[model samples]
Target: MVLLDMNGTFLFGGDRFGPNQDYASTYRALGGSRLATDVVQTIIQTCFDTLEVIYNDPTRSDSFPQVVDTLRALPAARGVPPADLALLERVIAQHELGRVPDDYAVSLQKLARSHVLGVIANLLSRKDPWLQEFYRAGVLDLFAVTVFPRMVPASSHRGSSSTKQSVRWGSRAPM
Candidate 1:
């Protein structure tokens, strides 16, 4: 069974600031506001944290707000103008998920003709916005299986052994 890691393997991830926005430009756009390198790192880190928080407890709605509150305490957000924060919020709302290239659909279409395509991602969820992303990208049906962290025990979330186990146990088609 051929396996694929989703990001960078087939889907190229977007910037920390979200779709169509790059980090440098985002930092520069902050203008007078002083956003420290560490704060920027925190912003990026928060992206990952948000996913985990969502995965662990899907009912929580405070992840983004909590992150912003923390950023507000740092120089990164000190006196941050409303407009800049709005942009940041927009980026955060996007979940920093990247766009799938046109070629990916074409390639997936071809690959599915013979090989059984599946995804073994550190993806946070298998539900909407996430799963819907694949649908929106027009490649949802192309995947025979999609493995996500929430689908397995917490220990399996980051290890290769767990990933292999997920692929083995989670697949809809035979491996």
Candidate 2:
């Protein structure tokens, strides 16, 4: 099975880009304010809590100062969503290829040519719309299996002692 992590795997993610305009604008219509650092902080704290549960380690906490320092260093994230320091740290990492590796697409295409290609991923449901962005970007069509976490039920979350219960992937050719 060709398992791949989501986010930086097949999609361009991070705080540098604004939210899906439709969604963001809708939130605005509903009286949403500028995304605050606290919102970002809560996301980080949730990840840390999940990690703590996994490792059973309380000492493993995140450093906000370090994150802030790192965000200031990213050229693309300057000025917008100023509170995305944590997003900056998590999203910026070396991947199999640039942003979305060319080799990943090539390899998936090659694999699909002969074998049943599969992708098992741990994903968050709230982020599913971004998958469509990759489709628009022409990267989603290369996979035979694309797993996401939204498909899982609340009961399944405890099955593997992991926060994620299931992945949402496709058997159909990427569209």
Q: Poorest 10 consecutive residues of model 1 by lDDT?
A: 60-69
lDDT of 2 by residue, 29-116 (tens): 4344564544433433433334335334333212111333434544433564644443333332111112445665565567666655
Write the residue-wise lDDT of candidate 1 on 43-78 in tens digits: 645554555555467443222223344445545466
Over all chains combined, what TM-score does candidate 1 have? 0.48
TM-score of each: 0.48, 0.41
Q: All candidates' lDDT scores? A: 0.54, 0.42
Give candidate 2 misplaced runs (Cα > 4 Å). 1-43, 46-99, 124-130, 149-151, 155-175
TM-score of 2: 0.41
Best by TM-score: 1
